[model samples]
Target: MNNQNSWKTLAVNLLAERTLLIVGIATVFTLLLLYPLFQMTPTLQASPNPPGEVFELQKDLNDKFPNSIHFTPFLLESLAGDVLTPNVLLEFKQRRQELFAKDAIGALAAGDLERQPYLVNYLDSETGVLMTGTHSILDPIEAGLIDIGTTLESASEEEVKLAVHRLISDPKTSAVLDFLSRHATHTPSTAMGHEIRLWVSPAMTFSVMTDNQKLGGGGLEIGVGGGPDVIAKEYLNRHIRDVMKEGSTSYAIWGIAIDANLEAQDEGKTAGIFIMFTVIGALLVVGLTLKSYWATAICGVGLGVLMIWLKGISSLIGLKSGLVIDLIVPIGMISLGVDFAVHALRRYKEELNKQYPPRMALKIGLSSVIGALILAMLTDSIAFLSNLSLHRSVIHFGSAAAMRFLLRSPF
Candidate 1:
């Protein structure tokens, strides 16, 4: 077999020229490893515009009302009670007044409320009707009774109960409660419980209402200037977490955006743990099965190179990796690299066992696998490229995988 002998001679000559292979490997590794240093951290944005008519409509809406859409975080506080009970209603009304006054002062001082944003109304008028308590519906003396403040000091428990019941059943009391429930964000926990809901404006004003209705008990809306995502994560979220940990259970504070980011971070940590496990398992299995330390090292190095290259390419292309990319790409690349490396190494061992020279064995191993690998990669590329019309993430992952396959072929 003169052709076989010629092939063996060529392989030997190539192997003898170790400098070329070393230089090529060094250049590839250096480029793959160093490129990441110049890259910025990836931002995760999931809701990029998709194709089709609905997306076009959304784009138009965004253009027409640039500042109309926003994510405003809300905090809810609730207190349990009968909506018409004098003392409970009084306390709730007083809390609202306190919050309103405090916000008014703060906004005025900050020049945010130079003109009153809300109208002055009967609630602010000098009505003898207290918004809460036994005398909430009528003046204490006008109701044919001693002043409630005086009665509470001397009245027996039964008398106090009777007074509260009388006040709750009053028509005037029903009117005031109806007004509040209509104007406020009201969600009743039970037949006896009433809730007040308020929107927190951009000026950090919050609504005052509370009851044990659901998780977080009640909600308060806060409209922070700048994006809610940024403010909630950087400032509001930290404060809320600290407040939650301080062992104060009187009220619960919930920030949906903040909670989501924290949960994502947790999932990322878990994914990292699994990735490390996968890498180690791959290395051990390859080393044992191939029975060659060199093969195992090559598999590990190939995977590392593929990951670095994917990240580098992502940066160069200005693609932000979303949750899907982060979850899929690393695992995908590792499995692909290991598969290629195992096939190559196994073929090399088979050639060696047939008593072929080392250089000839290496050449045959590479030649035997390259055609099948290229065919598989072509099919994979088609599948990935077909998805490009659907989402940006598909474009990113598909392109990255294609590049990684190209880069790993030489190894």
Candidate 2:
């Protein structure tokens, strides 16, 4: 106990008496860690399961069928309630043609051409198409309309209705509608039984049929199966969304790639704004409460260091961050960091009020609260570390949170 007390006293003396030296060392350490933080590239993808039976089976299947294509599907929902109308169909046709146009897609990849001169690499190289092929509800209707010497452009409301009737009355085409209805939901048919007529109901409400099966809500789903790989597929998906957003009236477009891009945008663009506001709010509150420029400066510096330590250490240790970690970690760190800073600054102020010498006050202030700080750190860390048994993301959150708590305690 005496030896422990001696070491504690020695630490306090070093911090209070040798303040410049301690600050210099911390500055150097922070600078060193910044390099790794800048260089660190975290994997942003989320994987819910470990590499166990499901993954192994998938790998085996993939190996068995090496050339199998995973179709990235975009769901488009019409805001106008019905997709079968003449105007909507004409709009869909135009948008679909634009999506398949090489020049239009090349324009989207204009800046990226320096890396690869050809946009065909993002779609089908042989066909020079943006996607391999598309499966759309508009296909059959358009085909039926074409057979009757009319197009989406020339067809009137009465002409479109006649074309739909002809398609539904035909046995072969009627089978296709039956298959589509069985797979898709919110599709209004003439009969409630298995045999039904299309276009009998105008109002459509497209929704998910089950957990695994996904159908576009009330609009056509464009299939992106022909892209060379994941990157190419994502490129197609993003451009498709852009076209739909610009050309269509009211539409909800979503897919794996589309959703991922949206999330990445939120994190990349909006997170900085959120962090700026959080820092500003914290500093403002601290300034008002303390009413001392020096105290506020110290708190701000401490908070900055704590954040740097958290990010720098996590980067150095190769911890990956995605949407969940990026959102949760900083908020948690800032909240805890502000609390720790306030307690230390308030304690230091109290010591100063008691008429202690500056050095004595510094030592006494830090020493008085450090034990409680350490206890809080340990408990917080343990609680976060308890998530080790959960998913990989949860484990990362827990580990990073715990580590940040430990880093903040010392500051």
Candidate 3:
């Protein structure tokens, strides 16, 4: 049509005559892509005061418990009956307390009392000790009257069986016995009448102790002064490792810090593999579908440029890209650009087959697809923008999509 011809002429003239403006736009987009404007904070709430009652609750909790953030590592242990009796438990507790006291003293002397760590066990609180029924037997254990090794060595098989049964049945020792039994690889039996044998069992003493420490005390928990940094977590892990190595070989340690680091490493590797596969697959599909090297290159370049421009706009508008945004933006832009380009190219080929002049064919192609492209862009923009009230991340995604649509409209 004459109107389409006129519009094409105007677009050509603008590109040819307003070269500086085109260059400036390109330069601005380049700078925006290269230099990001906003700092990315990958948290549940990226905004300073994100909307929602959940955020309000989070604020209230933070205000109430200023020093509540910390990671606690579980110290697991397995000990033989001869090595982990009530008296041995008492000895281990005393040693742990002594070590904590020594560390506290050293930290205080060095004026690093802020770095002092605390250890907690079942006996740390009266409630915990009472719950485990350890309070009643604490006196006997402390007095060194319950020497399990000596008794087991001297007592008859029947006496040992009776003693074991009595210990397991009493409320005072039942919890500890049950814990050890549960984690034990082999169950004990009095059926072997000639010789008394004790099997190795996993103990819940450390677990219960750590839990009590975490719940009843404050400093033993890691990350108290805000979520722990890498260095802090590593230091805590090292400290735990050192304690386990020096104190007893019977215990094993599993820290959140180590587990988190391993998980992150695994995630990074998986992402890298996925990205490689995605790039290869996209290239193969686009190249095969277009069949023309130039067309494939143009589509690829256009998609990259579109993403860069959208990211720049996002930066300018104080929007930070999170994992979801990073994934959605590229795929969305590619789908939009590819659909437009493919349809327009097909129309151009059809016009050329009808014996139209090259320039006229291009103009006709643009005329055929421009309306549809605009409609698609408008629909997509409206759909995304309508989700603004759902979540702040959705708002960010919608804004970026709208901006990309606007930037692509000129072409």
TM-score of 1: 0.58
1-411 per-residue lDDT for model 2 (tens digits): 674477567777788888899899999999888887788845343344455787567657654554323244555555665555687667766765665464333543321222221222123333222332344446666777787788888887666666666666666565434313233333344322324334633222211111111111122212211112333434545654676457467444555444453345356446656777887888887888778898778777877887778878888887666555566677677777778878888898899999998878888898888778878989989988987753565667778888978887656
* lDDT for model 3: 0.50
Ranking, lDDT, top scorer first: 2, 3, 1
Question: Can you list the residue pairs that collide in candidate 3?
Answer: 69-223, 70-222, 71-222
Candidate 3 lDDT over residue span 1-411, tens digit each = 676467655664465467689968876766657565334322221232346798667657655654332334343454444434543444445545554664555331111113544333334232223322122233323322234343432444444444445444456555545334355543556633533334444544332122222222233322211223332443444454455336564444344343343233334335434444554555566678767788778666666566567666676667644444555555556566666777777787889889998777776676777777778878877876776755565677677767766666643
- For model 2, the local distance difference test gives 0.59
TM-score against native, each model: 0.58, 0.76, 0.58
Q: For residue 378, give model 1's deviation from the true position in Å.
A: 1.9
Off by over 4 Å in 3: 1-24, 37-51, 67-123, 126-276, 352-360, 397-411
Better of 1 and 2 by lDDT: 2
> Each candidate's root-mean-square deviation in Å?
10.7, 7.5, 8.1
- In angstroms, give how far residue 65 of model 1 lies from its true place: 3.7
Those runs of model 1 whose alpha carbons end farther than 4 Å from true positions after fitting are: 1-33, 46-48, 51-53, 59-71, 74-247, 257-266
> How many Å off is the CA of 297 in candidate 3?
1.8
